[model samples]
Target chain A: MFPTPVEKRSRAAQITYQSLVPLALILWLLPLIAVALFSIRPGVDFANGNYWGVPSSFELFTNYGRVFFESDMPRYLWNSVLITVPTVIGAVALSCMTGFALGIYRFRGNLLIFFMFIAGNFVPFQILMVPVRDLTVDVGLYNTKMGLVLFHIAFQTGFCTLFMRNFIRALPYELIEAARVEGVKEWRIFWYIVLPLMKPAIAALSVLVFTFIWNDYFWAVVLTQGPDAQPVTAGITSFNSQFVAQYHLMSAGSIVAALPPVLMFFLMQRHFIAGLTLGAVK
Target chain B: MTLPTDPPTQTWLQRHRMIITPLMFLLPGVAFFAVYVISPILQSFYISTFEWTGLGSLSEQGEFIGMQNYRELMSDRNFEVSLWNNVKWLVLYLLAIPGGLFIALFLNQTVAGIRVYKSLFFFPFVISQVVVGLVFSWFYLPNVGLLNVVLGWFGSEVNILGNPDLATYGIIAAGLWPQTAYCMILYLTGLNAVDPEQIEAARLDGAKGVRMLWHVILPQLRPATFIAFVVTIIGALRSFDLISVMTNGGPFGSTRVLSFYMFEKALSEYGFRMGYGSAIAVILFLIMLIFISYFLWTMWRDERAARL
Candidate 1:
């Protein structure tokens, strides 16, 4: 809006702007477009040095079938689902209560506790890598999906709590006050009043945390090793190594690895954007 | 009105509900956070003082060689390269802010299919960085790679990731793909919330193009810009996945940022020197702490303003 609408410009200018938009988008997404192209080409295309030519034959089904059936990709994808879903549920449930507590109540250390979560969320993962891995190993959860899930739930709660608390703070205070005046129990107030209103936030966070945990490669690499517990992001590396130089297969594998979060984003675009742009609009 | 509420079990909960309710709610989250997030930070600092291969128990295997690892970091050439690359990353990665703003301004329209276009435009940010790295590596692949084929039209070519001098820049370019998209979405959202009346007023005074953007538009976009800046900086520092997948700190280890370097020094491939890795991690932590403190300070100020 600040740049003035293209409709306000000359007819030629409007047409030019419209044409340029797609051109710019194509250029911006060229690399991904190439991969999308690569994923569908026959395995012989790379060996034939026909990288950019139109695919002689579509091997979308064949390549993807190999990824799914001939490899550990399914195991890794399952591991990712296993790791991500629990983290989303655990983090969201924990943060809902924490957010309610921090947002609704006025008490000493409230701001301090909130800031601690804030600070912890921003600390680089490298710092946490050694100790968190050690902690997981010592607890005998090492190399297990449960280990990864538990760490994720804890680490993600930091950000989730920050988001939830701010969202809870924005809710009407009068509703809570009225409930208090009615002598309703605090837990019931949270359940019947606050929890119902937190639906949008919860939905937004679930999609967000799903993408985050699903795409997580660092902790997956550190806490787990084999396909037994490794998520797809890390598993994709082994997938690449296994099908080394088989561009079609590797491209297919990469797309498969990156699919869930991309699907999540497209389906939940509104909530995903809302969750991401939380503080952007003031 | 109070008579029906005087149940026997209601005495304690009613008397101190405010204090107790919050405490009850906070315990699980805090306990988990403390064990997983907080205490480990302290433990890392302690671990940095000892030499251990990350085998056996820490108390028995670790020899307390205080400050030796830090001393080694001072002379370590790989550490030096990694540190410089991180500086380069911090500087170059910020270009995404302006790049995103340019695209966001271009796309902030009501044209037909614009929503689909915007989503397609933002597609990169949603995909995992690992995939992005793999995609870019293929894009930069020598001989028959897309880049070389394109460059052949001009009869000029260069191997990007295979060259030591250019490899870090190549990886940074790949990272900017998604980072710019992220910033673009933020700016688009910010632009939606911009005041039309203010824009009209500025137009009346004959401000358009860069003048209007500099004077009227950007001031209103401060919140979005702050978020963009914070995320870009953080993302720049947390750039392990791209390096790992693309070059694996290759072309003579020229692409190692501190994050990747720490992992290389401390864990996989290299034998585990937990002490050395923790030392490197501590430095990265300290560097990040500077920005984290500033971010918290700004957020705290906003919180106070909102509370009052």
Candidate 2:
């Protein structure tokens, strides 16, 4: 509306706009497209300096097969799933109680507690790095999948709490008041009344957290080591170093590491966008 | 006699339950959050005052060397370089806002397959920064890379990432790719909710093109812009993954932003000087605290206003 819609423009202008759309999209995604092309290229293509030309042969199956079989990629993928799934569940579940409390109650320190979560969510990861690592090592959970999962759950709760609290605050408070008047137990009120209404928030938070934890590289590198616990993000970096000039294999591995989150985003695009843009419009 | 009106006892319990219920609900989240987030922040501040290598018994944890690490950071050349590079990153990263707005405006119109186009444009943000770094590294690889090949057509060739002078910029470029996509999505969403009636009113006043956007549309896009600003600032400050994957803060450490530098000092092959690393972390935290305080203040004011 602000820019004057293309539909209201002249016929020639509309045609020009339509033609330019694909051109701009291609230019924007050229790097990713190149990576996708590289992923299917045969290893010999790089050696022969055919980097920019059409692939000498399509080795998509061989390259991807080698990545899955010869490397620890599958293990890394499994680690990502192990780490991400629990993190989503733990963070979401914990935040639900916290969100319900802060959103409904008007007790002293409620605002302070809510602000703590919001502020904590924004602190740079480095500030927590040494101490968190030390804590993990002290607890003997260092270099383990559970260690990463636990840390992620705890940290992600900060953001999830902020999101969930704001969401729950926007819900109809009359229902909660009605339940209270009915003399329902506090926990039962939350369980029966509010939780059902929170389905959308829960869904949004789950998908967002899944993508976030799955794509996490920093904590993965900090708290874990090797295929024993490392998620695919860190594993892919190690894969890069090991493969050296094997761009084809590296490309395939990158694609594999990125697939889950990409799939999640596409499947939950609306919810994902909604989650991200929660505070943007208003 | 036993039923002597247990009213006071029941009232006392009920009164306490009001407080206890909320605390009970808060316990799990608050406990985990305090241990992982709050305690670690305080501990990091404490650790910054000590001298330790992070590789010894708990009793042997380094001696108290109060402010020594911070004093050293004052004169440390790498620290200065990192600080300067961070400034550069912050400045250049702002380009993403306008760049994204332009893209969003271009794609905002309703057209067939526009949804797919928007999704494809946003593809970079969904992937890990590691992949973005790798792709860009390959793109800028001296001769055989796609960028160099494209440049060669115009008879220009440059080793973009390998040169210290251009390495940070190169990495920032890579970072901007995804960041721009993120900003674009935010703007597109913001544009969707813009009031059509106001636009029509503005057009009636002959406010077209730049004047219309400046006086009418820009005012409405404040929330989107604010979010973009906050995210871009944070992203610039926390730039580590791309630098780690692509250059490793290299070309003689010219690209070492504070985040990566802290990681290097604390964890990488440089050997863990936990105290010094904590010192750097403390500095970064203080820098971020400035922005965080402003953001929180604004949000708090908004919350209060909404309540009123």
Please, what is the TM-score per model?
0.98, 0.97
Residue A161 local lDDT, model 2: 95
Per-residue accuracy of model 1 over A30-70 as CA lDDT, tens digit each = 99889989999998888898999888998889989999999
Clashing pairs in 2: none
Evaluate residue B216 in candidate 2 and report its C-alpha lDDT on the 0 to 100 scale. Answer: 85
The digit string of per-residue lDDT tens for model 2 on B218-262 reads 899999999999899989998999999889999999999999999
Best by lDDT: 1
Worst 10 residues of 2 chain A by lDDT: A176-185
Q: After superposition, how far is residue B256 of candidate 2 from its true place, in Å?
A: 0.3
lDDT (0 to 1) per candidate: 0.93, 0.91
Instruction: Give the CA lDDT, 0 to 100, for residue B292 in model 2.
Output: 96
